[model samples]
Target: MGVTEYSAKKLYAHLGFANGRDTMVAEGYRMDVLHVWGTHELSTADLLEWLGEFSPQSVEWIDDSSCTLRCNIIMINESTVLHVLHKLAEPFDRRVALTAMAAVISTMNTHNNGGDFERALRPPKLSPVEGTSDRLMPPCGRWFKSISSPERALCLYLRIAHKG
Candidate 1:
């Protein structure tokens, strides 16, 4: 198995989830595992760079040196396996602007809605690590996966997981 596949297996194993190919079954709900893995070390600059490469619009740093990140909205299932850990116990209020959640009206437009990137955002809940719990469910009822890369410097896990 490739790194991504291995990571997926590890993740499912961590969650005690059963899987077939790209799909994972948890709590009677089937979810597609959109897993990605790499050896990139965790670093604020590198994290921003990767975010810039993937989702750039809502990237904000609470402290660039500290590598704190804030996103407006995300609909992709991001995950990696590594060491350093940082998680948000709670999410921002819907009344709060600047970073609204993205909605999944259709698969194609999951990343954007009506040209607005931030709407109906549901961020990920904190997980001690993989396999320690069932799939982390954000407010939107979608699966959210957050994993660190092999480097332990950066993690691929993002916000908002979508089911195709």
Candidate 2:
């Protein structure tokens, strides 16, 4: 589908979109196509550095504003998602990882035919949570360590709304 056609579809309603602007205060083009928000302490530079770790062909930074970042991320399969999750877990908290996963999954599911995300997060055996037979719970604690800091946490609001 064309970029405009893809953007027309309401792929992610959960991720809030700010019409006519990318960031909260920025007064430029309308870039709020896909918004991913989570608690994080990383700045724009740090985020760009993290993105650079991935393959150059996979991630293309179209816009890198002071308060906003627009990139075209190409996730080929579940392995890509896992790699992203691993990278996110390295520096950020569980919440941040979860948010990124959700955004990636949602975006993938929206464009793809079947639900690839279901298989990605599904546990091999039965869920360990009580009163739940087969809950879709991400293996957070087991997969990665949950670390929190005493200092104030910043919200990492990443909007993937722009197409170009």
Candidate 3:
């Protein structure tokens, strides 16, 4: 769940995984898992900065308009999915973390298709939208939502999935 030092959108789409930024051309390795922040409001620069550092082989599907997703893999890896889920809590809702994590597990694909991403837009547990958002996203969760806790829930889901 720990994101490395790479927040550039260029890194996310540099591989041209499919539906990536126009700046990217050639395709890179698709991911084995994916995490779509469908409702998260991200600036072009911010999106690029965060996604730019992806391993290309880490994502499987995307809801990114300015931020799409794609991935490659034989089977879904619980740890990989859980890792990404835990990272999504930052600047986003906590209750929705579980929902978002589930969505990622539900939407892993090689081709970049942002289907039914709106479901992720709503704030988790009735949380108000943050004032500092770079873009307009639907509100989710309570204002007091803790970031790390939600990630932990996602991790739980992944652990269960791993066991199953």
Task: Write the residue-wise lDDT of candidate 1 on 112-147 in tens digits.
Answer: 543443343335566578643323222222122343
Each candidate: what lDDT? Answer: 0.32, 0.37, 0.33
Taking all chains together, each candidate's TM-score versus the true structure is 0.23, 0.23, 0.24
Give lDDT: candidate 3, residue 121.
45
- Give the candidate order by descending lDDT: 2, 3, 1
lDDT of 2 by residue, 48-158 (tens): 455455432233344332122233444443233334433343233357777898898778877775367667667788547763422223323212221321133343333
Residue 106 CA displacement from its true place in model 2, Å? 35
Residue lDDT tens for model 3, 3-62: 343422322322222353232222322233333333234333333334344332323322
Winner by TM-score: 3
The ten-residue window of minimal lDDT in model 2 covers: 141-150
Which whole-number lDDT from 0 to 100 does residue 100 have in model 2?
A: 94
Cα lDDT of candidate 1 equals 0.32
**Reference-based TM-score, model 1:** 0.23
